[model samples]
Target: MAKLLARAGVASRREVERMIAEGRVALDGVVLDTPATILQSLNGVTVDGEPVAAPAAARLFLYHKPPGLLVTERDPGGRKTIYDQLPDDLPRLVPVGRLDLNTEGLLLMTTDGELKRQLELPATGVERAYRARAYGPITQEQLEELIHGVEIEGIRYGSINANLERRTGANVWIEMILTEGKNREVRRVLEYLGLKVSRLIRTRYGPFLLGDLAVGEIGEVKQHDVVSFRKDPTRKGGGEAPKLVEKPRPQQRGMQQIPSAPKAPIPKPQPARRITKTSANRADKAAFAEPTRQAQPGRDPVVLTKATKVKRFYDAKPKAGTGAGTEPVAPRAIAPGQRPKVFSPELGRNVRAKPGRTATPTEAAERKPAKATPRTAGKARAAPSKPARVKIHKSRTRK
Candidate 1:
């Protein structure tokens, strides 16, 4: 009966057993007293007065649980739980393992209670990895001793593979991998080592990682991957753990106690070689040193380098018009006593320049007739003059 309730996604076998002991599990309104009751199916079984639904195909999801959320479905103290953060569309699921209220990272959620038990069982030997940031002095040698396991305050912890990743002052980051995840195991172990854990984050579990999954985001595992992983979870082959990022050592005021890795002496960037006029001349001569080869009738033409093309462009003279094939304008010479003439855009013609002042560009102005004022009221008003008409000359045609 416990197994039936567990497989039906009601809860874990242990929890179901507890529910039966509490008389919450019933068969057609008659509360079942024993978890060992003979039952072929859950047809008439009901838990907490709700009819049990048939279990669906097993499904798995990877949820990046943020801190401050409990793993349980509900909390007695009204604290937020993982279910509150989960999407409403997700099916009834249970966590493979529990994370502390403040611990954050990769959390496996599954629909099958049986599968969850299989994963959470310490005998299955599925590894769980965590990165803990703790304060206190600890050495790699001390952490290495955990491989043989340890007993703290009468509670025994299984063999743990631990390594000191890096340190900052009195604080250090440690990476721990273990199979048996006892309640408050990580914090207790670190506390036994005289280290106060400031932050704890689970990085990997079994074959899943919390890789790049944002806080509170959930992702489903592929059906094929879940199937393959279930075949042989104890195998050392699983998801690759991300490299431990070493925290930058803070700059100290005095000589360092621990010697850091020897840094490669940065070769003083040699002052950039200055291009002298002599070197420029030599380069220009060398560029054209090859005899100019003429293209033969049947041979391929010479390809010009970018530099050569640019040189030719600058050396080319400006043309009078924008046409590509227009003839280049010849340089105009000025007489010794004559001032240079400048183009007056306002006048639409080239005008002689004054030696003292320069021409300032002005906009084209329209000419208006002069108006007679009161002082000139008695005087005859000038007649309005007509605009001058220019004659158009047409080209003569050959007759």
Candidate 2:
């Protein structure tokens, strides 16, 4: 009975059993007591007081779920759900796997609960790819180490092919590909590595991608493609996956059949040609062979070196009062009590006179300024002497 309900797109087998336990599934106005009570057909069977519709052909849809929406049908907290964002004419679809409220990316929706279960099972080894922008210091070597997998908080995550995409100031973008998508696995693994994940986007899942799928938009997979994918989930590299479709006309929503254009013939890939040492030597000789042309009389002969090519520019003429080998100008005479300023070789100009000090033409410029004091602005005040003690008072106290 559970299998029948699951195949009928009512729910998964386990969910059907749970519904029976809750007395929500009834037949002939009598609630079912157990899922074990099997019937050949769903004659008068009803789920939640509604007659179950006949199982139509299995359908698959790629929905670009935006962040901040629950994947469930309804939320007890009255938060928005994925259903609220979907079109009104979409069928009773179920998400293959749950995406967190803050995780935005590709979500597979299917009418057949059995198909959903099959796709969600980890044993299927369908690869899921995600791009995460995290804030922290992470190196390419550290990300590469994730290929061995990491364990955090007693939960052992499977091998992940993680690569450092690029760095943005204090944040880094990481691309990770994994098969086992345990609950919060990506977040947990990244945080354990001392990274704070700011944003995570699932770019690819199995053979499908979230390509060009606008948020809140959905595109259905053709029936033939769905059947082929179910037969072999690991298939790859034959053709491009379906893209996210725009909203159809209200009248043509579910019944419209998109005509596929003829596909161009793909040329068979040629095998790589193996080269022997002799062939490699021949190729090298051919590449390095000198041109047969004789050098022109007035032109410099072209020289080719194994090192990088460098273009030598003509040496620029020295500007006025600059460059080496130039004679130094004599210092001008200084008037009495006035310091003569010295020209700084490093500064390429006359150095400024030191504060409260004089400089000679040959004197080196002061490297630092003297510390300022209260006396710098005015004359220093003399310390006040203590008052003279009275000897008569002391004598009277002694008497």
Candidate achieving the largest TM-score? 2
Q: Show where candidate 2 strays beyond 4 Å.
A: 12-15, 22-31, 38-44, 48-51, 237-399
Q: List the residue pairs that clash in candidate 1.
A: none
Q: Which clashing pairs does model 2 show? A: none
Residue-by-residue lDDT tens digits, candidate 1, 1-399: 887777777777788889999999999999989898988878888888989987766788888889999989788999999988777766778888899999999999888877787789999999999999999989999999999999998999999999999998889999999999899999999999999999999998887788887787788887766777788777654553332222234578886677788999988888889999999999999898987867786688677776545457667766557447877665788889898788987899999887775434442222334566565657886899977655555654332
Per-candidate TM-scores read 0.55, 0.58
Per-candidate clash tally? 0, 0
True-vs-predicted CA distance for residue 168, candidate 1, Å: 2.7
Whole-model lDDT, model 2 = 0.84
